[model samples]
Target: MIGFHFSNYDPRQSGKSKFDQLLDLFTQLLTYTSGDVTEALQWLNELDKKYELTDDEYGMGDFIDELKEKGYITDDEQRGEIKITPKTEQSIRKRSLEEIFGKLKKTKTGDHQTYKPGLGDEVSPDTRPFQFGDMLEQIDFTESIRNAQINHGLDSFTMQEDDLQIRETDFKSQTSTVLMIDISHSMILYGEDRITPAKKVAMALSELITTKYPKDTLDIVVFGNDAWPVEIKDLPYLQVGPYHTNTVAGLELAMDILRRRKNPNKQIFMITDGKPTCLKIGKRYYKNSFGLDRKVTSR
Candidate 1:
């Protein structure tokens, strides 16, 4: 017989090291600063001064050196500037993914299983009589053999088209998602800081699609007085602009992006804090922020 033993749990035994804790905080600050490495480090130092994030054994200087050694940041001597590397950008996305999705379990790629049965990689338990156009590989040999034995006898085994069993496979769909982000001044109004959360959600979703669902496509669009697409790598540096909301432009751009994608399933997700307040017509601007504008909303 097997036995089990249990021990007392200690919260202090958590696996994260001092550097990792600081790095997590630093990454979050970088998002708020729009990928400004110097500003993020300054904020970290301030937090350390107030909250005692580091001790004498492992100070902020040590963490900074570790960041350089790990290739997460690069310091240019000639230009007198410090910047985050692509590796750090990827790390921020991974952290955002984990924070929002809660550490997803590892699985095979393209695992979006659907109820509809068709040609797919994953086999389903449901089976049906073989159809005229069914492929030979889809036939369940075991069930077909059983059916043959039931139809005939063990003395002489024979199989017919009616005796064949076709196993159904779950259909996996690829999706083309257009994520529209509102960059109008309202996102940062009232000292609420709404754009940071929007940025995090975008980063998390982009990371999820790229890593877990490789076949899917994700396009990011930012809308203010106008709208345009941004690359996945530029998500960390997105900033809110001093412009009015032009949701129509964002939707039009999103639709244009989806039109170019070959995926069968398409969707649009918009993140905004205010209603439509601006519209453009033939080089002229129509703006109204008091309430919902009829012309803008109707458009």
Candidate 2:
């Protein structure tokens, strides 16, 4: 058998400037703080103090000034806090998408389905003879000209409706999606840090849907001992709580949210690492962590 070869990547093996390193550190800290600029900055300072990452000439204060100049954050006198800009939030979402899914596939061969060629409302690959009731815009001018040339000699070329070609197409409308994430205490069991990856996936899905499918609407919700909706920007700050998995509550909330959406094309995605262990019954919460609770799982 041939030996396998693998290469290791050193992130710090670069010619990045001090400012670049500071920006990278800030971006990393943003995830833990949920795009909160002040919190991220404080964490960055603490990290810098611990690791001596910053030099005397280029310190954290200078980095903050650079961040303001770079349009990443802005100070609000009204709120008495610096907030991350929309551009920074978008950048965070994109980074999360890249971290989880890599880059978007450029071809038609992947888990993500690219548009297929069909005779529907949009453009289709297979074309047929021009039929009645087809719009003039649908006619393939180049193909029609070629057909005319084949039917009549170039010396006396003539075109007719019979020589026209129409394109086949398919139509798709808006879609509504509900993304459910599990934030139970088990997500970080034994310091595995499962919630961070789940949060990245949520951000990735939201960014992908909102960008690729502009007409589509996406709602994200997290479930633990309870379930509630969270904004896309809040994904970076998602953390596991001292609670058990409540898959039933998550599913119920997803269905309830989808039911209110006007779009007929609606779906739900549940990301979890364990089975249901808790659910709310009227005013009381039922908890079961010993093993797989059949009643909770059944729902």
Candidate 3:
């Protein structure tokens, strides 16, 4: 695991403080453990001894105590375990999402499709004359007020158009999304755990689309020896397998999944590192660990 370090801090502007140094150190530790904070701290202890770091000035122990004190990390008393705070998780997620998705484009309209206010322009084929059951917005307000004034007396300022209001219609947009995740052996090979970040992104995106875009459909497929649909909750525990990359399988599965979706708008988001290494022949899996096979590439 590579340790990450953030060195962009401006001591002049933010002050050359211990907290900043600790943040830098914590980031460095994250690179090593991919934010497996407890494991990183344990490594930090070993590193402190190997480097002979000053205990009073730059001690990992002190830094962790400070981290817990400041709520960046917390202790689960019952579990006897230290865990990252919700704040840290959210910050890491925001940073990770921004890094991968880039910035969300700013636009005049809302990100998602929204219906126009008031009773939609689409009216029933039969337009009945303004009646007691008709919506007020459907009723021409001016004409209604005029009718009320005429029917009542001059003192009948209490106008009655039956307080008609528009009956709002609903419009639905069809959206289909294919979320691709790489499950190549490199994800966890040589002790680097890139899979964690990938899994987190998958989980977050799944949660986001499911909760906020009820009208839209999101399909998650993992590509390794073969691509298949996996539930969102399964993501957090997803692990890299010995199987090599079969990107074609992933794409094929994604396309197959999208084909089932009748939505007019379809999009695919693939997350992968390195090239393809395996392909399938009928029901048999063709293994290739050295290089990309042109046959698979063409597929």
- Return the clash pairs for model 3, or none: 2-31, 2-32, 3-31, 3-32, 4-27, 4-28, 4-31, 136-164, 136-165
Candidate 3: tens digits of C-alpha lDDT, residues 91-134:
44444445555576765533354364324444323333345654
Task: For candidate 1, write residues 1-299 as lDDT tens digits.
Answer: 68998897532265789998899999999999999999999999998898788888999999999999999999988989899999999988998988888866876655778889987988999999998999999999999999999999899999999899999999888889999999999999989999999999889988989998898889999999999999999999999889999999999999998999888799999999979999989898899999988888998
lDDT tens readout by residue for model 2, 195-219: 7677777888899888877778899
lDDT: the better of candidates 1 and 2: 1
Clashes of 2: 7
Top TM-score prediction, candidate number: 1
TM-score of each: 0.87, 0.80, 0.53
Give the Cα RMSD of candidate 3.
8.6
Provide the global lDDT of candidate 2 against the true structure.
0.82
Q: Estimate candidate 2's RMSD in Å.
A: 4.1
Better of 1 and 3 by lDDT: 1
